[model samples]
Target: MHRIVIAFLLSSLSGLAFAHGMSAEDQARILNAGLLEYMQLGATHMLSGYDHLLFLFGVVFFLTRFKDILKFITAFTVGHSITLIVATLLEISANYYLIDAVIALTVCYKAFDNLDGFKRYFQMSSPNLTWMVFAFGLIHGFGLSTRLQQLPLGTDGLVLKILSFNVGVELGQIVALSIMLVILAGWRKTASFERFSKASNIGLMLFGGLLLLMQLHGYQHTQFPDEFPLNTDDHFHIHEDMEAETSPLTNYPNKLNFDDIYSQDEVLHDDNSYQDEHSHDGEDFHSH
Candidate 1:
């Protein structure tokens, strides 16, 4: 059972590992990418977003009715869509690591709620689940916006691009939810699932906490940029030093530029000597 939980986490995080970079090809595609391509990109991003998936999973973990699932999912969708489109259009930027860290905590929050942690530990009624999901959906949308803005979304047809992306996001959500529903269906049939449901939520909570810690670690490195040696321009400096040490390109022994090859006095003397040589050559040619 623990092995199953670990395998699930590893699979989800693998996609997350490549989520943000927006490869050179992806960036180029965004410049001229059509509605369909933008839509595909959106779907791809949502599918790869493990935090979003985990939160959705936590939300639906106990939901048995289709109508309830739709209602909750719709609320989440509306909340995120409002923020995703508005924040993106307004070009509102936030620190991505901080935003993502909050998103990670959202998963933990949901899992904790699923496990009745609030009632057990805090001795308080849990907040309205619907409203809370919607609110966190807004935050999740902002996180999506941050990632989208990394692309060179052109000024023209911006609204269309955003809409297409949103459409793709919905498609991706549907695909992911379908799979979760199938799995949940199969698992709910088993006696083990009844016994391990709490353990499963606990696993979710732990994974979410792990993700949160990773994001915070990233945030700290971002805040103190100097500590991360890889970010510094040390590589360029080293290349320059290597050239200076081992290459004549830095010294330019064969450089043709006047400033590099000739002193002012050398230029003047060369000019005078050239005239003298020309006079001597002319005399010799006439005499011959």
Candidate 2:
């Protein structure tokens, strides 16, 4: 049991690095992908989305009745689906790091609610949990939309692509929920569960807090790249090098060209900088 716990912790820590971002290879492969491929991508995203899974776990932690489970889960599904489809279709977006930070908070919120923190600490009742779950689901869907936008989603068949991805997310959620329910059901029968449920929720909160901090740290790096000792270009290159070192396809002859990806990004950044500089110069001349 100790070994299992340690192993799980190690895996989770490592997974944090790759969470919520697709690899360059994945992006490249999906450039001209069809609906089936989009569905696969969506399924893969949900499976790897630890924050989403944690929130779902907290939601169903104490729910034993199938009716209650179906109701809450359906509410969550409808909520996220509405945002996921609408946001992506309208091309509405925000900083993904910030969105994910909020999502991490949702995980913490659910876990805290699970522990009856409101009644214990504040002598008050918790808010309507079903409504809260639905609200958080909207935020979660926006987070998903942000990630999906990173791909080259073409205008052709856009609605179909989005629907396919949403369907895949539901499928992935079903699979994850089944496994969680089975585990919870078995654990509930054990004496250890009575002793450890509180501890488990506390652990969930800690994990959520950790994820929140990491996302904020990433946001800092992205928004204030100049504050770091390394220039933005150098920092990104270092990241690319690290990815290459860790990638299993490092020696593969047909590996995707990460340099090309960076080069394209550099071009776009330079163009934006050029336009901004000229615009500022124009304003200065007019002011004078």
Candidate 3:
């Protein structure tokens, strides 16, 4: 089935994030990370990152000019790369599970655009989906950095490591886009192009929608650092608990089920166990 193929593709990318591919014994080597490794990681993540690739594909899917694509890509690159580096440098990062969940939603956004969801729903053009995609790119960049940090590569070349990874990402993206452009152009040359265009975009939108929904309920209690009390840097630290408004299912609903779910260790332990199972899957789907 189509879902199987897409699932396989995503799993293939995540598999490449294995730290075992490097050296586990070199944990002490702070300067061990090199250009070659970052290059490999960058290229690997870009291609393997089904969500990221789909986002980029959606962003440039409409633009027909090289310069325009570069401009758009540049905006997105800057937005995300800034946060990615800062996350590692200042140790300021968002919840890993939540960010990824949002990235999945972005894929759905693009697919929805392809299917003309916006026009049918909002019927507006001034504030389009491009800006939304760019904002999501910021989150996506952090997602990339998070995966990179998980690797054993020495942080000594932290700057270089991040930079090299960014470059490799762009390189890989160019390669993917080039092929896609060729296919689109060729398709345009055909007579049935117009007939199939809507369907193709719809397929992309459908894929995006599926990714979005998958990530929303990925974890039952999407806990992260909360920005309540100020930190030593005079800046509030918003760790895993930053998503307060949206995580009612985990926090609010629990208040309602305080007796049933969180009544005692015997009850709470089982509830935690169930949540852990859902969190491990890292995606959620609930019936309204």
Candidate 4:
């Protein structure tokens, strides 16, 4: 069940490989200048990152208790923060796809654990899952920081900018978590919670699987997304002058009424002398 959900999500994400975001070079330019850009990076990274948000959604879904949520989230936060800072400051790097692939697996692992699949399917011991979660988080953090580093960073105030951006990421996560909690709590009040809940878990599993495969696809092509969904096209071009169907352009083909593309004077003056007749008729019409 969770697998199905994961599949759909990953399908959507698989487009990530081809789905354009800030290029590493472009991101470096943004990273180098202005506090505004730095702050925006934090917000943008969180906003644009589907994988991060999906994992976060999985993390918070089952947590109804505040203390428990705080505890686990704090651990995850600490893990990410440590690496994000260290990675950016120390300039350590790793392959993006592998890290992202692991991150996708983290989503799968967490969702599966939440579903208690291990206890049911394998009858095997899965110990210290939180620790595992934290470790994976470090990997995810490194992936993000590496992307940030790809942007050119002048030695001037680099540390401060990265710190500020990371802070923004934390803030964005908090906001996202709060919203998810509010929505999930509201949903729990309804009767469908039990009936559809397993299905939802299945969805998460599927999303994770797709992301994992999608990342793998990118590794194969360097254009891999972190999830699955075979895509047709992400962008389109338009030419206003041509008809969309026959002309192979984006615009409607008005019948070759070249006269329509004329100046006011040209339009008013015709070889048939209709313009002269119309002008004479206009004065009469006005008088009437």
Candidate 5:
């Protein structure tokens, strides 16, 4: 049991690195990709999205009836699909890191709800689960939209492209939920599940917190690169090396070469020098 728990934690942590970022190869390929190719990319994104999967897991963890499952899932599906399509079509955008951070919170929210944390700690009933799930689903879809916008989604057939991708996302969700339901149904028959359900939800919450911190860390690095001791170029290289070492599940023949993406001169400017160059109202404008 201990080994199984350890393995699950390790697997979840490893998945954090590969959560829904497009590689250079992906960007290049999508330049002329057809609807089917777009569908494939969407499915791939959903499958690789660990935060999304974790939230879904928490949503279905307590659902025993097929009708209940169907109702909740349909709500989530409609919610996400609405944002994914509309956001992509309108080119609505936000920082992907920040969006992912909120998605992480959604994961934490679901787990907390599952464990009845509100009632236990606050002596109050939780919000309506189905409505909350739907709201979180909207946020999750926006997260997906942020990633989708990274691709070269041409304007010629943009609507079709978005719809195709949304379809793929649904297909991927169906596959993932099918697997989750099967595992949960089988586990429900065992005594261990009753013994361990609370522990599992707690673990889910911990994982979500970890992901939240990681996303915020990434946001800081990207948005405030000059604040770090190492320049952005060096930091990116360190990340590249770390990814190479840690991610055994993925094979990146065409690894993301940040050299093509980041300009060293632009990112390597000293903070003091930058402050010296720019001032606001006769005072140094310092970044905090």
Candidate 6:
């Protein structure tokens, strides 16, 4: 059972660390799509969003009580929903890679907390779990907002569309959480669960670290592209070379000028015709 949990977490994180948001076609669909379509996009995004799922799993890892789950999830939802709406509406946005980097860290943070890293490493107590989760949710919402902003959301019926999308995200969350809870419940019944709980959370922390590194690397590439070993300068030089090589004048500099050559031919033809006419007149005069 614990084996299943570890495998599931690892596989999900591995996928999440590299997954992109939506495709161009999906973004195009959002341009003229209705509320239901937007809703579907939101639902699909959440369902496929491994980073979000892992963090959520970390959040509910030890919470056996239904009320606690409700409280924590609600706090998280409210926090993210506010920013998702407000940020997109007010046009408040940030670099998504950076936002995602922080989001990845949240997974690490939750996993570390789950394993009591603070007590073990620093001999300190953690903060209020509810408030911290809410805070992290705010950050998560900003990430969501960045994705929504990529869509061509027009002025008309924008609020309704955002609301619908939020609803869909919640729906997706519910479905995912249900499955996770069932898995956890089953694992709890097994005797090995207690033995492996620490290891599982440790695994979660490792996954989070990988995600964090990926996000930071992405951020670095976006911010300082030239720092990478791959020669981007070559790309620019190749473009310039192509432009120069493809120029008409550059390719045929030694070729004769067609306009000038045609003008010269016409002038020579006129001169020959005038000489021939005069010669014909002379011949007629001599014959007479």
lDDT, residue 220, model 5: 94
Per model, state how many residue pairs clash.
0, 0, 13, 24, 0, 0
Worst 10 residues of 1 by lDDT: 279-288
Q: What tens digits encode model 5's per-residue C-alpha lDDT throughout 1-288?
A: 433543544665688766568888899999989999989988988888889888998999899999999988988998999899999999999999999999999999989999999999999999987898889889999999999999888789889999999999998888878877777877788788888889888999999999999999999988997787797798999999899889975676768768855765556655435554445676865542
- On a 0 to 100 scale, what is the lDDT of residue 48 in model 5? 82
Off by over 4 Å in 1: 1-6, 230-288
Tens-digit lDDT string for candidate 6 (148-195): 888888899989988998999999999999989999999999998899
lDDT of each: 0.86, 0.85, 0.64, 0.72, 0.86, 0.88
lDDT tens digits, residues 6-90, model 3?
A: 3433553453344211244333342465787677667766776777777776676667788887777777777777777777666
Superposition error at 201 for model 6 (Å): 0.7
Which is the better candidate, 2 or 3, if ranked by TM-score? 2
- What's model 6's TM-score? 0.78
The 10 consecutive residues of candidate 4 with the worst lDDT sum are 234-243
Cα distance off (Å), candidate 5, residue 205: 0.1
Model 4 alpha-carbon drift over 4 Å, by segment:
1-21, 24-32, 223-288
TM-score of each: 0.78, 0.77, 0.62, 0.69, 0.78, 0.78
> For candidate 6, what is the lDDT?
0.88
- Across residues 210-271, which tens digit of lDDT does each residue of candidate 2 receive? 99999999899889977776877988999999999999877888868899999999998877
* Model 3: CA > 4 A from native: 1-31, 126-130, 153-155, 216-218, 221-288
Instruction: Give model 3 RMSD, 1 decimal.
Output: 21.7
Ten contiguous residues with the weakest lDDT in model 3: 19-28
How does model 4 score by TM-score? 0.69
The whole-model C-alpha lDDT of candidate 3 against the native structure comes to 0.64
Cα lDDT of model 5 overall?
Answer: 0.86
Q: Per-residue lDDT of 36-139 in model 4, one digit per residue for the tens?
A: 67766787677567777778777877788889788778878888888999989998987687778888888888788778888899997776857876887787
> Which pairs in model 1 have colliding backbones?
none
